[model samples]
Target: MKQLLILCCLCFLSAATLAQATWIWYPGDYEIWLSNRMQNRRTDRGTFFPVFWKMDSHYPLMDFHKDVTLSEPEQVRIYAEGTYNVKLDGQPFEGTPTVITIPAGKHRINVKVFSQATVPAIYIQGNKIISDSSWLVTYEDKEWIDETGKTSDITATKWLHAGSWNFNDPAILPSAFTLPVKPMAAVKTENGLIDFGKETFGYVKLNGIKGKGKITLYYGESKEEAMSDKGAVNVDWLTFDKAVSQDSTLPASKAFRYVRMVTAGDIHIDNVSMLYEYADVNEPGSFRCSDDELNQIYDVAKYTFHLNTREFFIDGIKRDRWVWSGDAYQSYLMNYYLFFDKGTVLRTIYALRGKDPVTSHINTIMDYTFYWFLGVYDYYMYTGDRTFIKEIYPRMQPLMDYCLGRRDKDGLMEGQVGDWIFIDWADGLSKKGPLSFEQLLFCRSLETMSLCADIAGNQPDAEKYRLLAADLKAKLFRIYWNDQKQALVHSTVNDDVTRYANMFAIFFDYFNAQQKEAVKHTVLLNDSIQHITTPYMRFYELEALCAMHEQSYVLKEIKNYWGGMLRLGATTFWEEYDPHESGPAHYAMYGREFGKSLCHAWGASPIYLLGKYYLGVKPTAPGYATYVVEPALGGLQWMEGTVPTPAGNISLHVSTKEMKITTAGGNGILRFGSSTRPTCTTGTIQQTKDNWYELSLSPGSTYVINYQSVK
Candidate 1:
């Protein structure tokens, strides 16, 4: 009762906090927002304001400038003529005829431009101050806005200016571009400020108006030596030629915050602006789910295809965009399966929406070990939503057929062998690579696909796939199994060395019992070369052992691996072990250990598998119709966890003292846990260190199960 009371209060407080937050504005309400938008700068704390050039969906806005020069920093001040309350860092900034200051810094500003009682042209005079004479002429440019309200790109012409700073003036220039909607300017009108519906957005522009000509920027090896915060870097000694007419091209370094133009003489001018239809997206938010944050990540991952087209969402709220960086595909797939097995209804629907049939499926598989099949299998294990299964089977069938249909002449699936013989884990072993592993993975996915077809009542397809998979397995054994090694060779063509490949095949039951035991012995006790050791050294060792039911070894590896991660200052997993040089995201090393995250999804998979199998909490075999209650504790102090299964919520509280388990509050029967070893069939069970147990029970019924301890 006390816990429930506290939970209620916490929920209320969270709701209130989100409701009270508001957007803030900065530097008064002037045209400074235009400058900020182009540079992708944010101010007023972390609140994002719309770009001046790109207005909101409804309003049209635009701007162009004639004078361009880079000295300290100068601005064409915008005068607000109307009285309004705008935001500054989630706080309100109000009043009329406000002055906007533009400094040479990064800032994303937001300001409202009002209309006049009559038609008034709003213009701000360009300001320039040229203090240097030794600088040579560099390049010039022209700017424009795409007012069409759709996808548009603009370019600038590059040329050299020969005149001196004194000759460059704002009076004479090129054609004046029309604003997308209304423009903001200071003038005497009937109303103090013109009101133009809601606010619009766009960019500002600066043509190559020359002053002291173009200045070639120099830099040191490091940012510290380049220039100081006080602008104190001496470049007076470096000399270059005067400006000559050239194409306006942006270099990689200048792409971020600055644009440079040169002149043959000493003239320089600067302007950058454009109007765009944009919304405020930098609102501070994250995917926060109490029970399944990992699964939430997966739910978001399926929408990777949307990254190029649209922003993501959880529920209906939009989310930040995530790109596919190639290094993180493992994390993405694992998350997909985690959510799929947990039965997140919204996530399931979201998965349906992400289906692109060929491109997405192929991308998910070819790029990441054909790993998508496990998620599909898990989806069936969680929901038993036959309708959904049927819908997806056809879409995925073609691809599955392709993999199964393309076996070698010997009937073994033909493909490049992955780094080792193992399909799921990717690491190099002596003389082994990725092809054989990929073939194994292809074989595994086919078998699972056949089972799915059977469950969907597509028996003919199931039989066909099943027969094909069986034939492939037989040929694989005939071709790859080495009689001398008494284990599966790394490759039939190479026959070079043996490693995790044979063990993985045995773990997945791709071999018979005698063969499986022989391979297990070879990996765990027989082979010195493949023995599991350090967490980093044997990253996938525990999972492989678990697949082989080498409980003692699995337990040992788990303790060492998990403890090492915790000791490494990991709050979450990381892409690598060493905290030091993991790339731009340096802080990620402090999170979890998701090494290479593309293959293993690392820390996430370990946690999920431990929670599901070791904790004896799992989904029912027949989808959500029931629950599986068998958990493997692997000699932990104690285990307490809750998994959201299709039947309802399955809670697990295992007493290590007596090796007993207590399950409560779930629908269907606990099918897997017995007095022996727990192998989940339906409801729940207490898994022993080295035994097999199964359970059967109904929802809301209390079941107490005890197991004999091995130690």
Candidate 2:
């Protein structure tokens, strides 16, 4: 009898421990609020430049509640942002009570808050009753009261699990969130102008400034841009009447490697420095090889990607610091191979897929909307977190419905008036009719919807989406596939064929082997076909090549293209790189001086290419429960790197003669080809095909394979 009592006490203690909580908000409300704050910070030539499309806001009023059945009475401390009212078990707490005592029983705690400028959020703490994502939150609780003081039914009101991150401490509010920063001194000062030696982002601080005067600071991503006061994208004008020397920090963060400070009326400054603001993510993935140029390209690509991975995965640091869906889609892929920061990926996905009124497409682009769906699909595939899918699936349904409603007479996606048909930033790219590329992406998105619906436990919707995807896939081939050309035509308009659809088809596995090989030669290698210019399309273009086992050829192309940027003194990759463009002409884009961003997120494709294709570590099943590791030398004498998975890291070292692999988690199949039979002492090797061998690998095991180099 005493032992039974002790077991009951232990179980009670465990239950209390499991109730530890963190900050909570209406799911995705904080993301929308924060994105608005971040995107509105853009300044062009000292003028406020905001998005051309309609901006969204969080619900001004929100109600959060949690039902608890406690073993004993508990005192709970409450903290909230915005004007709020507290209620205990459907009864009002006279005022906004910071501390409330509740009797032990089945009870519901509610906090309703209103804020026009910020998101409504709350943090609650107690021994057994605490606040976290487990709490239910609703923007419209709909508990209307009548004249008799009787509340109406709220059965129609929808409640979702509250959204949260690592904001566990009640002392720190979510509204006060900011990226961490560090001081960086200028590399050199040239007559009133200071250069930070490389393109950077963050607020600039002026140290030891004295006297009364007007100071104008021009910010630039390039040396020429800084000197061009009128052309600089960001500028700061400050009027100082200080009697004593005071340090001043800029009001907003700007992207610039150089700053030109022009002072008038006896204003003087001592030194210049900056607070380099960045996301706190560790570099778990690394790549090194015999080729120095490739290594340099990889390092610069990593830096470029990291710089753009801030509050959300933005497009670039210099201009339009917005969470673009298509750009973020690539960033997600690159992130999977690099930081594998699930928080950032989830944050970005939520921000891009803002609240579900399903107005215009994401970023007002058709292809981008499709990319958003694909991003969600890839997120589930890589992380294997079904909870996110369950939470996000509702949003996905409406988005797919929006696309379905917009289909043309033939049921293909075509650009409407407000929709931006941004396939790529190519010259004279036809977007007139229902482009095959859009249909291809739309088909894939439907497939994603089907997969997510299954995970979200909506079997009817899953079947609906599956049928839609199947029908669309059939149409994709029937309508777009051209036999004589042996490739998917660019558009149904004039039967023009481009690399976009064909390349995407290759990696998406939309094409069979015969069609894939045919398109690989006819479209990919066909220079007569309009060459893809942006690194964005190049990502898929190269992925298609690597998929076709053209890694050796891709190695040369990476060196020529990415390496060309390095030869041109690129501290980070460019928004677009054209080798033919010479001198300052390289800096000019959008018909403006220094308009091109030097650190674009989409340019960091090598992170994905090397990790997935070279290291060959990809999840066969979700969450790395089952995976495949097939390393490719890609013309390198030796290469080594780590690919991050939800389970852990898969490390690999490969040379021409032998290969070594170690994984921290997951069951992996190590497959490779050799001129002779490969020998593995730690595991049994089987001949999968002629000159190919496969070994089964378990978690935390290292395997060394001795083989004669096939190449």
TM-score of each: 0.47, 0.95
Clashing pairs in 2: none
Residue 441 shift from truth in candidate 2, angstroms = 0.2
The digit string of per-residue lDDT tens for model 1 on 1-711 reads 999999999988754553121111111111122212222432211234332322211112211112333445554333222223333333334554244334564432333333222111122322431212211111122432232212233464321111111112223221121212322221221211111111112221223444444443322111222232222121111123325422222211110111122224554433322233232222111121122433333223222211111111111101111221121323322333333222223222223223223322232334232545655665566566665565456546766655545555655544443211223332354323334555566677778789878766677778987887787677667766787777776666576445555655754667787777776676446655444322222434555566554545665554445444444333333233433343334222223221122111233445444544555455545554655555555555455555555444555666543333334334444333234453333345543333444455665655555544443
Report model 1's TM-score to 2 decimal places: 0.47
Question: Which candidate leads the pack in lDDT?
Answer: 2
C-alpha lDDT of all candidate models, in order: 0.38, 0.89
lDDT of 1: 0.38
Looking at model 1, residue 668 earns an lDDT score of 43
Backbone N/Cα/C clashes per model? 109, 0
lDDT of model number 2: 0.89
